[model samples]
Target: MAHFNKAFQFKTRSIIVLLTVFGFQLTAQNWDVPADKKAKNSYIKFDKTTASEGEGIYTKNCASCHGNPSKGNVLKSLKPTPPDLASSGTQKLTDGELFYILNTGRGLMPSFKDVLSESDRWKVIAYVRSFNKSYVQVLSNTDPTKSDKVKVTMVYNHETNTVRVQVVAKEQNTSLPLKDAEVLLFAKRYFGKLPIEKGLKTDESGVANFVYPKDLPGNKLGEVELLVKVNDEVYGEVESSTKLKIGIPTDKPGLTQQRAIWGVLAKAPYWIIALYLLGIATFGVFVLYLVKNLFDFWKKGQQ
Candidate 1:
């Protein structure tokens, strides 16, 4: 009986230790997302209607901290304030990462999984991305099969430093060169589409040429998405995206390039600051001198 009790105690202690360890591990995990969730592709496509809807939802739910520039955040005074979602750092994150962040809020951000429908959350991201040009999303019909039906090919020429985009229209499970199709090469900018020139019709080869400049700015990863679109009246509009290494990141601003709404004395040049202080002091002295002269004139009038 004593042996039996000893065995029972050992088993209970083992279970307790294991449970304790497991709990510690959970606490230490930092709320990391699983690999599968991080790899998920978003079902939502960018469209004006969806974005507008997203804007509304964002204004209602998120604008207090992350929506408008002037009033984007009411929670700015929170202990861990929400970041400006439109900034370069937040814009560089992949769609999946953003989606996960939205799905599971961290720190000061509350999880919208309870408050917002999943689809509405995605719209909010679309609206937030709109503030910056590079994060500009491509609009397409939500029908997955349509995007799959069209094929787009893009090639970069190292010698000429140009991009060649070929778009083929698919019909009846056959490949055909879509000639004279209205094609536009869109370089994703912060706020809107920057057409690579004027919109051009594809030639007999269904190919359009873009002079990719080496100096063109990209995201923090030194990459740019060249969005190729073929708008067909009957066949329906189709689009494809290709990533290019365009070198320097344009999203990040330089010291000299930053615009300050509210200025601080520390940011001013030493000489400029000295002159400003001197000017203020001189103005104060002049005011005092005028006040003294007025007092003397009043006393003389009284005499």
Candidate 2:
């Protein structure tokens, strides 16, 4: 009976340890994608042409670490090695889930949201989907053409330091508000769009509000380019870019404006430029001396 008790205790401890490890892993890998993003469907149809175009794009962008689909040649050096796109693990993910993963990269993976165009990103997914034989795509019911009729307007308030966005779709002479839509606000940066805040849902009146950061720098005129993107069940997706004079005016000089070692050729420090030229002249003189000596040695040998 004592031996039986010991054995049962050991098994129970083992189960607890396994469960703890699994729970930790789940927490670590959790992406926390919103329900709407996970449910987003591709507006573009997945076809042979798209898949082909995606293949070229994938080869240029994704093939570095993910390797060719189904080849099983993923870059193993990475901590969490990239998975084979053709594998069951990748194939099982929903299209929206995959899209969200691509947009919000984790750990070693970098976000491709800014790097790839919306159409190109979907095409890359199409190429990835081509590897799975049993895969069937469910296209989005939202019409792409209807997105053109959607209008997005932004109003900034000085007192609240918030931007109010209104999204409406025009159907002939009627303008209907788009409520309960997914709205994301971004500030245009040199490289990519910087998200102002977490995505917000429109209210009953088809309005979403975002709190603008007070310290964000802008051009000399205190103008900042604000980009608003809206995704609705009815209107599909709409994007609007607007310039607002709300940012803190920053007239900071460019990095290369003054003379420095790292500055452009024309803007390099005079002392550093002189030293570089001196080094080049010294090398040239040394080469000439060596050649003259060699020539002298050859003349002596000939005599």
Candidate 3:
């Protein structure tokens, strides 16, 4: 019947409008990449070493306020709850977009441009990605707990010509004394290519003693430079000079010896010697002139 057809048409039209509105809403909402796409390129090739470094950076610079992202310590009162980085929200964002946010900052978050290098920011991005279960699963597949440790420090002694250098292995809050660990020491000329001596281990107090030979050539009477290495893993360097002087007696000689040498050299008066030489020259010249005049007179008389 005509009425039935009208109802059917209305229903169909209503359904079509609803479908169109839903499509628009879905398009407006930003969704993450499809599961199939993620599966195809699940692994984001990044430097594992760099991510490990970013872990430390996160601990030092970001841990104070953010705590651990895994623990959900997000600041909710802020405009938008720090987007759950572990959730699809982060995955939906492209790497470049995420990088921009991290470098430029958003809301209360400070810009990391001045704080982190470009490579470092990428490392951090990799670390943030790791929060996602998919990425976490990938990381675990590679090796869940790979060792990622590094050391950065230099130590040495100048006076004793000894040194102990090693990488420090303590968190920012912790303090490690040089006495607690064993330090290694290596010896060589400051700028020498080859190491003059092999490596030596440190004592309980992390001290390494280096005694230079008294008769070592080139160093006997001048400054000796030595390169110190600790644990065979770090370099501790110091420039030390030997205390040796030749022809210079340690004890002062008696004044008599000095005066005797001076007396001998001063015995002949310089003024008297000069006057005697002048008188001899004058007498010789006078005798020569008289002989010449007598010879001239004899020649004239003979003529």
The TM-score that candidate 2 achieves is 0.61
- Runs in model 1 with CA error above 4 Å? 1-32, 67-74, 136-303
- Name the lDDT value of residue 3 in candidate 3: 100
Ranking by TM-score: 2, 1, 3
| Model 1: lowest-lDDT 10 consecutive positions | 254-263
Give the alpha carbon lDDT tens digit for every residue of 135-155 in model 2.
Answer: 989998777678899899999
The alpha-carbon lDDT assigned to residue 303 of candidate 1 equals 100
Please give the TM-score that candidate 3 achieves against the real structure. 0.29
> At residue 280, what lDDT does model 1 achieve?
100
TM-score of each: 0.34, 0.61, 0.29
Model 2 segments more than 4 A misplaced = 1-31, 48-81, 107-117, 130-134, 141-155, 165-182, 187-195, 201-207, 213-243, 248-262, 269-275, 290-303
After superposition, the stretches of candidate 3 with alpha carbons farther than 4 Å from their true spots are 1-47, 133-303
Report the C-alpha lDDT of model 1 over 34-87, residue by residue, as the tens digit: 664454444576567777899899878877777473344546566555667776
Highest lDDT among the candidates is held by which one? Answer: 2
lDDT of 2 at 125: 97
